[model samples]
Target: MKEFRMAIINLTSSIDRCHNRLDDLDSRLKKIEQRDLEDQPNISGLVATIDHLKSELNVRDQELLANDVEITGISETKEENPHHIVIAVATKLGLTLEDRNIVSVKRVGTTRGYIEGELRPRPRPLVLRLVRRSQRDDLLRAARVRRHLSTVDMGLPGDTTRFYLNERLTYSNRQLFFKTREASARLKWKFSWTRDGKIFVRREHGAASHRIRNEADLQKIFGINEVGAKE
Candidate 1:
């Protein structure tokens, strides 16, 4: 009887020890969860800081391109000089752009294949880097005023093609601008444009303009869902 009693006592002690250990483990787990909860705000803040830094970097990159201009829809030719084309366009705009004013000019992107019933391959855009931001701004303003500027106006002999000039934007900004324009058109918004590498959209002629910085802004401002469906 005494031996059985001792055995019972041992079992109770073991169970107590086990309960204590389980209690310790539960306490440790709760503390860990509390720590994680406490850290969540800091984690969120860190993510926001990183995003802000990325946006600042994009702005800096766009600033570097302030003195650059992008000319699109000009047909390319073999052994053609892009510098001469820049000069000719400037002359047509009644702006005298000396050789020193132009830093560099080159065609960017791959030449696209000819479309159906088209004779020549689609030409890539020209990136023209100028000595001053004023010169770039002047060219863009003149081009906008002369909305019908064409290759023939620049004295190009081949098929006359309408060309457009605009400020050079960073690749990311360009994508954002494209998305904003697409969304504006679908939502029946009247005007969408970019200025100084920022995208802006308006509902109509006199509606308030909204600046779109990212896709999330598009969703928030336009009630667009993730897949671009109207909410």
Candidate 2:
């Protein structure tokens, strides 16, 4: 009979110890949850700060390209001189270009191999960095005025292909511009263009131009979400 009572007491003590441990565990869990809740706003603030810094960096990077121009659709050839091509284009535009005014000129990206029974791979873009910002601007303005400048006009042999010249944009701005154009078309916006490495959009004829600096600007001006634009 004594042994039976001792056994019952031991069982009750064990149950009490388990209850205390469970209470301690539950208290620790609640503290951890509270810490996470307190830290959520700080985490969000840090993320915003990081995003702002990145945007500032991109703007600085774009500023460096102020004197650079990008030319696309110009066919490439072996043993071709890019400098001569730039000068020829300038001559066609009625603007005299001296070698001293040109800082650097080269083709960008890798040249792709030719495929049989298919058109030749598109030529990589040519990036020209001029000595002065005004010179770059003048060249681009001339190219815009002569919108139909062709390879043949530059004395290149073969089928006459249209080439385009415009200001060089940073990779981020380029992606944003592409997205803006896509959204503009879908939303039926009238026109979109880039100037001085900044993207602009017009809703209709005689509408105010909206400057789009980032994705948020896109959302604010065009009602576009991160996923895609929506009216």
Candidate 3:
């Protein structure tokens, strides 16, 4: 009977210890949950603040790029002059341009490195800044109408290089534009295009066009969480 009583006492003690341990774990779990709950609003507020800042930055970038256009596929010449190239392109597009109307013209990338056996490197795009917004708009519209500007058209008849002109977008806007295009393609959207450094997507013909300024805008347009989240 003494041994049996001792055994019973030990079992009760073990049970009490287990209950204490369980209670301790439960208390810790509750504290963790409460902490998460308390932190949620702060996290949300921080995100909201960040989003507002991004919007402001994007607006500023657009303003900075308002009078610029990007021209691609013009072969880099030995004595490259971006101003001359712009004049050549304008002539090809049949738009009369005065030198004063051009604010600046520049190649967008580093010079090519020489490699003897390899094929000649492709040329970088040119960023052309015009003095007036109307000039930029007219140039873009004319280019779109032709839709087949090439180096051959610009006096490189022996070469088969093609060229394209687009609105000059900021680096961030460029990334978002590319991702929005990819996402639109995946979802079979009808159209995706840029205007004044801003991205717009339309789901179908005659449907509402959605402006995708950031990741959240894209998410809302596609009805998904963080589509192109990597960008």
TM-score per candidate, in order?
A: 0.78, 0.83, 0.77
For 1-231, candidate 3 gives per-residue lDDT tens digits of 999999999999999999999999999999999999999999999999998998898789789889998998777776777787888888888898788999999987788675688477777789999999999998999999998777774654235678998999888888899889888887789899998777899989999998897887888888675475444
Q: What is the TM-score (0 to 1) of candidate 3? A: 0.77
| Each model's lDDT | 0.87, 0.89, 0.85
Query: Model 3: runs farther than 4 Å from truth?
Result: 1-36, 111-118, 156-158, 225-231
Per-residue C-alpha lDDT of model 1 across residues 6-39, encoded as one tens digit per residue: 9999999999999999999999999999999999
Model 3 residue 56 lDDT? Answer: 94
RMSD of model 1 against the true structure: 5.1
Q: Where does candidate 1 have its weakest 10-residue lDDT segment?
A: 222-231
How many residue-pair clashes does candidate 3 contain?
Answer: 0
**1 against 3, candidate with superior lDDT:** 1
lDDT of 2 by residue, 112-218 (tens): 77768858877889899999999999999998888788877567654578888989999999999999998989888989999999999998999899999998899
Clash number for candidate 2: 0
What's the residue-level lDDT of 146 in candidate 2? 87
Task: Determine the C-alpha RMSD for candidate 3 after optimal superposition of all C-alphas.
Answer: 5.3
* C-alpha RMSD of each candidate structure in angstroms: 5.1, 3.7, 5.3
Order the candidates by lDDT, highest first.
2, 1, 3
What clash pairs does model 2 have? none
